[model samples]
Target: MHRDQPPLRARSAPELVPSLFLDLDQMLDEFTRLPIRARFRFDPDMPAVITVEFLAERGPSLVWLLGRELLRRGVTAMSGTGDVRMWPTLPGGRPASWLLLESEEVEALFEVPTAELAEWLDATYRVVSAEAEMDGLNWDGFLMELLGGPAAASE
Candidate 1:
């Protein structure tokens, strides 16, 4: 519910992705509660993340950079950067966060982007919303799936 809440744990990467998909619709509703607008633009050619520097070229605004990255990766990612006036030491160091969409529903499609593109988009919204509700919920597991998994942590 709240951003600080503990995350739901899943046994495997596959499980996690689908769960996020299921939560997408709910996530959209939660985002609307925020002061700023969080909209997803679908580009058939791109996945979700665009080049980060490309965003900087346009302007320093948060929205532009985020939107570009989302388009480039085809997955949802978010980060923050306070202007120098706010936190001089942390300029452009605002926390970076990302979420991967691996919906079982979407993956099951016979086509790359099935007619359920809208549903996948909605699932992306949910992944973002849930992450917003929990600050400590790192996207580690999701990232592992993208890049290969790492060795087990030493006890």
Candidate 2:
């Protein structure tokens, strides 16, 4: 029997977008992308990333871990440089955002509804403000993990 079902940490309620079809123009040659499941999630543990997971019938689920701040600015205008970037679009009279994930090997583009993404970000802010995100982090522990060694923690 499970003693505790839900974890103690607060998770920002994920925003669900149904039938979030792609808005293609920049990359028409690429194959059509039909997003079966798409949502934005924020975990208190990983407060920096506003993760977006795209689940399709074929192949593994692709995920993009974008900055929470970047997404907030992206809804209204362009934000970010290299690696990741996003901007609002009005392709075929439908409102959407162009989410670009780039790497040296390959690059990908995703079109998400502007309103949906905006609402999700708003909901997350309601649960946890930006200033409060850094309150409980163990910086020394994080650095130790990065350096792969036992490092001293500072208060």
Candidate 3:
């Protein structure tokens, strides 16, 4: 028998400024619309890797909280061969954009206006979300056909 995991609950707000919290909330909302690909590497020398891709049905609240915690500790950007990317939104004139592109071997920072950041995030979210939705539908069809016999195959 298969059992569904319980829903995740967000932690209480950290001691961040109000504006930072607002920005985090806005970004979290956008992130929830798309699927996020994450990879964790525990050993630097080993080829072993763990990867997870989260869809809209599974929220990334923990990711958001971790980003906030990083910001609180004064981390602006981080990237490596790992599959996860974190963009910690900070106050003041700090860079509002951070990207960890593991496949491209890239980790960078961008200082852009808030509106521009939001627009970029929205565009990326739309593209990724659409792709994720299609992938999910395809997987569902495959499973149905596999488990339900020939009658369930798609035309």
Candidate 4:
């Protein structure tokens, strides 16, 4: 994480989702702030998506929150990809596995049992951290832009 990274602020779900979808550079900036490692993949036969690996050293609260959000947005559990084993000097490094969340996968996974989702969220939380908060940027305004509306920037 950068020393000057901003803090995480409370934003509505609609406000944040658009940022994840359009602001690639800002999303990358936010991703780098977390201790966990993830990758963006696009296969010709499959929809483009990201694969996140929850690593150790990240705070559990953060991981759980991310897991919950991912689950809410339809992320899926992956198999035969690889195992999540512990690495030295990392947090929640062990006992983790991969989740492959395609556009459809996310839609279906979002319909799963909340209890199961919570469990996964807890597991990921063991090593994740919350993203840095934005100060002047009004995330809601950015979302409006994605909806084909004018973006009303904060003064």
Best by TM-score: 2
- The 10-residue segment of model 1 with minimum total lDDT is 106-115
Global Cα lDDT for candidate 1? 0.29
Q: Give the TM-score (vs. native) of candidate 4.
A: 0.21
Q: Tens-digit lDDT track for model 3 on 6-108?
A: 2222332223211121122112333342223332111111112211122233564323112222222223444332443545456666445444333354332
C-alpha lDDT (0 to 100) for residue 93 of candidate 3: 60
Clashing residue pairs found in predicted model 3: none
Off by over 4 Å in 2: 1-36, 90-92, 149-155
Please give the TM-score that candidate 3 achieves against the real structure: 0.25
Best by lDDT: 2
Supply the global lDDT for candidate 2. 0.66
What's the residue-level lDDT of 45 in candidate 4? 16
Tens-digit lDDT track for model 2 on 1-155? Answer: 12222223444544432222332333434676644556566775666677777665689877778899888888778999989998887557567778788998878777766776677677666666899877656664556556664332221
| Window of ten residues with lowest summed lDDT in model 3 | 41-50
TM-score of each: 0.20, 0.72, 0.25, 0.21
- Locate the minimum summed-lDDT window of 10 residues in model 4: 18-27
lDDT of each: 0.29, 0.66, 0.32, 0.28
lDDT by residue for model 4 (54-138), tens? 3334464112112333433332333221222111122343322223323422211111222333353444333232232123344
